[model samples]
Target: MTKITYVEPDGSRIEVEAENGSTVMENAIMNGVPGIVAECGGACTCATCHVYVDDAWTETVGGPSVMEEDMLDFAFDVRENSRLSCQIKVRDELDGLVVNVPTRQG
Candidate 1:
C-alpha cells in the first residue's frame, strides 16, 4: 500500500494506505477524507474531486492529461497545481504523496 496524505483547507491532514493501481480519489472516498466530493466517482467526468498537488511532489505526480485539464475548467480556484484526484493513479513511487484539498469543489 502507498501512503497518501490529504490536507484539508483548514490545515487538517489525513494519511491513508492507498493500494497501488487505485486512483487517489478512491482512497480519499474510502477513507472518508473531507473536501473530496467525487460526484462522478472515478469516471473523471466532473471536477468535484479537485485537489492541489503539493508543490514538492508535482514533478513526481506529473501534469494532468488534456482530457483532465478540460474537466478542471469547472473546478473552483484552479491553479498551477490543481488536479482532479481521480486522474492520479497510486503507485509505489508516490508512497509519500501529499495533496491539498481546496476549501470547496466545483
Candidate 2:
C-alpha cells in the first residue's frame, strides 16, 4: 500500500493507505477525504476529482492526459499544479504522494 496524503482547503490533512493499481480519486473516496466530489467517478469526464499535486511531487506524478486536460476546463480554481486525481494511478513509488483538494468543484 502507498501512503497518500490529502490536504483539505482548511489545512486539514487526511492520509490513507492507497491500494496499488487504484486511482488517487478512488483512495480519496474510499478514505472519505473531503473536497473530492468525483461526480463522474473515475471516468475522467467530469473533472470533479480535481486536485493539486504538491509541487515537490509534480515531476514524478506527471501531467494530465489530453482528455483530462480538456475536462479540467470545468474545474474550479484550476492551478498550474492542478490534476484530475482519477488519472493518477497508485503505485509503490508513490508512497509519500501528497495532493490538495479545492474547496469546491465545478
Candidate 3:
C-alpha cells in the first residue's frame, strides 16, 4: 500500500493507504474526499478529478498520457502540474505521493 496524502484547497489533508494498481482518484472517491467529483469514474473523459501533484513528486509519479492531458485541458484550474488523478495508478514506488484537490470541479 502507498500512502497518498490528498490536500484540499483550504489546506486540509486526507491521507489514506491506497491499494496498488488503483488510481488516486479511485481512492479519493471511494474514501469520500470532497473536491474530487470523478464524474467519469477512471475514464479520462471528465476532468472533475483534477489534482495538482507536488513538483517534488512529479517525475516519480510521471506526467499524464495524451488522453489525460486532453481531459485536464477542461479542468477548473489547469496548471503545469495539473493531472487527472484517475490516470495515476498507485504503486509501491509512489509511496508518500502528495496531490492537491482543485478549488472546484465543473
Local accuracy of candidate 2 as per-residue lDDT tens digits, 31-104:
99988999888998898999999999999999988898999999999999999999999998899999999989
Q: Residue 39 of candidate 1: its Cα lDDT? A: 98
- 32-106, model 3: which lDDT tens digit per residue? 999989888878888999999999899998988888888877898688899999899999988999999988985
Winner on TM-score between 1 and 3 is 1
Query: Candidate 1 residues 1-106, lDDT tens each?
Result: 8999999999989999999999999999999999899999989898999999999999999999999999999999999999999999999999999999999999
Least well predicted 10-residue stretch by lDDT in candidate 3: 68-77
TM-score of model number 3 = 0.96
Candidate 2 shows a clash count of 0
lDDT values for all models: 0.96, 0.94, 0.91
Q: Over all chains combined, what TM-score does candidate 1 have?
A: 0.98
Per-residue lDDT for 60 in model 3?
A: 93
* Candidate 3 backbone collisions, by pair: none
User: For candidate 1, what is the lDDT?
Assistant: 0.96
TM-score-wise, the better of 2 and 3 is 2
> In the order shown, what is each candidate's alpha-carbon RMSD?
0.5, 0.6, 0.7
Model 2 scores worst on lDDT over the 10 consecutive residues at 32-41
Best by TM-score: 1
